[model samples]
Target: MHLTDHDRAMRDGAEGDAIAAAMDLLIRYGEGLGAEVLCDVRNVAGTSTQPTPAKTIIAKEHGWDKAFSVINLDSDADIAIPPMRVPTCQLQQGFNDEVLSISPYRSELVELQDGAESFASEKGINILATCTPYQVGNLPTRGEHVAWMESSAVIYANSVLGARTNCEGTASTGSAGLTGRIPCWGNHREETRRGTHLIESDVRVESFLDWGMLGYFAGDVVGEQRPVLSGQLARPTLTDLKHLGAAMATSGGVEMFHLPGVTPEARTIEEAFGDTVPATTVHYTAADRAHVYETLNDQGSSTDVDFVLLGCPHASVEQMAEIARLLDGRKLHPDTRLWVMAPRALRDVADRNGVTAAIRAAGGQVLTDSCPAMSRTAPEGTRVFATDSAKQAHYLPAILDIEAWFGTTRDCIEAALTGRWKGELR
Candidate 1:
């Protein structure tokens, strides 16, 4: 890989030892990916403050700075860390203290995360502790290059917002945060962004549930490759698209997709395919949708739901309002617990607007920063769970060894109220 004079200077320790290590990692990462050049990036989403066993052990052996140097920067050198060079934010991690009484997660982990947060904040990393950074205030401009870590967020950035990013990991995003540079490969290049598979929907994908089912089907059919959707679609809001992307990322390793007329990069089907023709054309019919629905619910056997989770990629304000409306006058069943995961910023919006109060009145808690899947904890003895998020339904069963039922938000709310899973595909 070729480095500019500035890159060379950074690698030669002109900026500092920490930055030099960061530059060295970027160079090696770029070259390892067969990338010839590195492009400048201003926006980055990472998980440097998340408390893990590895991070804890390293921090115990060698202070937080060395922990960051080894875990984040991929360097063993002892050097002082500096403020982020570019704008960066932390992603979803362990549960916060507010839900300790309800969740089975440990309190010590939360304390460790609090200390990690302090260290990260002092290093100029914004604690936008949600999977969806675009939801808060970190919306990247169209066609902007960014290094984001979350799979759902990566899909959203690449497809919905037209920003360029691969499904980045901890170390690469750490390097990007300090250097403001990432490899100009994968989704960053225009040629590689073209659609690989074409999916035509025969069933009208209008509702949030329908969109999520379509995304799950698309991901399974296309697998790590990009898909272009053509027919039988409705105008999707941010929340609907958010669910779609998150579901796709969960079922498969889909980082980017194109809705042709809807997404920014493609104005037509031809543009979505670029100069090359699509490799395959897949038809998504009503039967396929039903199959996806069944697949998402295959883990469940009991009709009695012990828990209901509303968000996987974090709930948007619109979703919060809808959830609030559904549970306005209803209280949860005595045996069931309901929690709506959201970004802290949007949780504040719900709090001020009485949305949170409405849900609370219904005995549902709207928590932020983490979910059951990330925290690896659900309500104690949660044998069977129900959720509106296809992503959560697809993941939590395998992660927690619990059963899940996937359905509409209304169906989930009904389960939360009645403690029974009466959800069937409508």
Candidate 2:
């Protein structure tokens, strides 16, 4: 593979041991993938909490600390909580406690505290462990190249924002920051951006959760390819889009999708495909939506729900406010444990807006910098769990061996109130 002067210098160990090791690993990764050259990454977003100490230590050594320190575009801190970490763990064989002790996971109860501090002191690359980097300030302009690690962010940036990026992993993304280049693959090319699968939805999705389900449906059908979406129901908000992107990322390896009139590139069906869509278009009707529900909610009937989780992609202040409004004066059932996860800044805003207070009064705990899937902070002995996010409900159970259920936010609130999954809500 060809290398620039800087790349050669780094490879030759002129930059010092840590950077040199990182570059060598990057070169090997690039070579393995047949990446010819590297591209500069304008922003990076990754999973907030890591499970093992080895992963966290490696992330920190590369650039996780530096990425979270700066504000991305949209003026909000570009931080997001993704569903990547184990929910809970016990002492097990082959687990390395000594490695885990390298970084105190909760030594300081603040977002990006250890990573940010380490970045400042050690002078590593910038890396914010948020899923929604575009919202927080790492907004990459249209056509601007970036190397983002988060799956949803990759799709959102490339499809919605018209920025270019590959669905790169955390380590490669960190290396891109140091080398200032990424291999021109995936969404970086124009021809690769066209939709291979066509999706037409007739379901009337009114809630963020519904959009998430739609995304899951699209992804499950389309698999790892881009899909062009036509037809719709209600207008989607940013929060809804976030859920859609995340669900798509989880359901499949979809790095980009075109929603007619919604995504920047796809104003119309013709525009989305440029006349290259497959002859057959898959129609997702209300029945199809029901199919999605049935497929995702595979767990058998379980009246008792031990845990309830809200806020995948970290709820925005506005979303929290809406939750608070729906939950005012309503108490969560004593048998149910409720948790709300969001970005630290948004959590603070929700507190000031009394959304946090309302949720707490309704028997919910508001946590920042992590989600149930990312932090693995669910109630002990939680055999049955429910979430408003379809992506969470679909993936968490398989990972944690718990029975997971998907429902509307209203339905979730009703379950929390009743401590059971039944009645009109079910």
Top candidate, metric lDDT: 1
Residues 175-257, candidate 1, lDDT per residue (tens digit)?
89999999999999999999999999999999999999999999998899999987899999898899889888878899999
TM-score of 1: 0.98
lDDT digits (tens) for residues 20-105 of candidate 2: 54467677777887877765555544332344454344344544532322211111123331211111111001111221232233
Candidate 1 segments exceeding 4 Å error = none
Clashes of each: 0, 22
TM-score of each: 0.98, 0.82
Clashing pairs in 1: none
